[model samples]
Target: MKKWIMLSFLLIYLAGCQPFMGGQAVIDWVDFIQWNGQEYNGVHNSEIADASFIEKEIGEVRFKVADNVSNPSYQLKDGDAAFHEKGTKLYSIKGKDNIIAVKDEAAINGYRIYFAMDNSKYKWHFDDVSLEQVKKIEIYKSATPAGNQQIATIEDKAGIENFLEILSNSKEAPAFQPNTSTGDPISYQIILYTDEPITYKYSVHYDGNTYFWYPSETAILSDDIQHFISEK
Candidate 1:
């Protein structure tokens, strides 16, 4: 009776553990199916099925219907160098053998920083900003005749890390308000892009524009980042 009881307990434990393993497979399958459809349609797609009918292999997996009326589809096609999502033809793996791993979107793409300051009132130009250690930079004016001139580009390594630090350390102010008294007022916008992009904008207040992008705000700006923007 004790042996039978032990066997029953073992069966219960195994049953309990199945869901945990199955949960992970479900998550992986969800990722695989969406990725596959993204490749076929050239647009993002949603997952439609559960983990019930996935077949896992040593280095690959097939997604299929339980009844087997439709043909099974290969979701992951593992290659010697990297794991390829069969549908998208995009590499999901990062690095080389032994050190190989899944790719991180944020780390691989780096950061894109965009700065736009009112050209009419402010004298700053993208040319004035320093880029000694920056990886890549692009400068352009807004298509609008009166819109702010813009600078946008990507950075990585120490350059991006420093920029992130500055942003995090900078002081926060109240939500922006436009100057009603003056028809034209100075405005500024700084946009940083990573996995998620953030925007920071400064505009003149009704009373008077109090924000300064230099000396006071300059404390947040690294000397390696830029030099002069306005005379005052």
Candidate 2:
């Protein structure tokens, strides 16, 4: 997984620059997402939503006049007029409510561009999950060599019911923020199979003190789920 680029700099406003902070920053970055079939590398996604779940848009953005495009890893300013890179995926999470414009080299390889928003513009509504319809549950945990390896698989009726109950009770959290921080929180992935051809995916994140599902839905992992992590 690509860690988000954290550019920490004191804002230095300059004359003739855009109204916002447009001074020459001491730090910068330039990278595109590299998708290798199964995984997206070199970019840290702002949301936990899978690529299939997002509303993607494409467009080009000219470099700001003050930005030195020659610098490989310099930070771009979204001050007033223009942004830095050509946007590949302008992800609209909730019908344009919470939109994120990504600058990636999707034409060549995947590149990751970062944008920050202060808040999510919409409240999300998830479809009701039916426990009986879930045929199987695959649980994966973080590791060194394998990265994310299967820790447990649930096929029994009782086990599936318990897991879903825990998931349903998850508390909501603040989902979106425009942060350029380098910290990557630890997370787990769950792939639930149902009677239908469609599959369900959920992410469990441990943000130091609390464990919640990413995108504002999370709870304490049940002992059954935690046991899988412990044993693995």
Could you say which candidate leads in TM-score?
2
Q: Residue by residue across 1-232, what tens digits does model 1's lDDT show?
A: 2211000001122365564332322211112222221211110111101122122221322432122212122232222111223232222221111111222232212211111111222212322233343333222222336454554443556655564444345443434344558564443344333221212222211123333233123322333333122312
lDDT: which candidate is best? 2
TM-score of each: 0.23, 0.41
Model 1: clashing residue pairs?
Answer: none
Lowest lDDT sum, 10 consecutive residues, model 1, at 40-49
Off by over 4 Å in 2: 1-128, 142-144, 173-184, 207-209, 215-224
Give per-residue CA lDDT, model 2, range 127-206, as digits (tens): 43456777777776654364666678888888887877777765554553322254565667676775532345667755
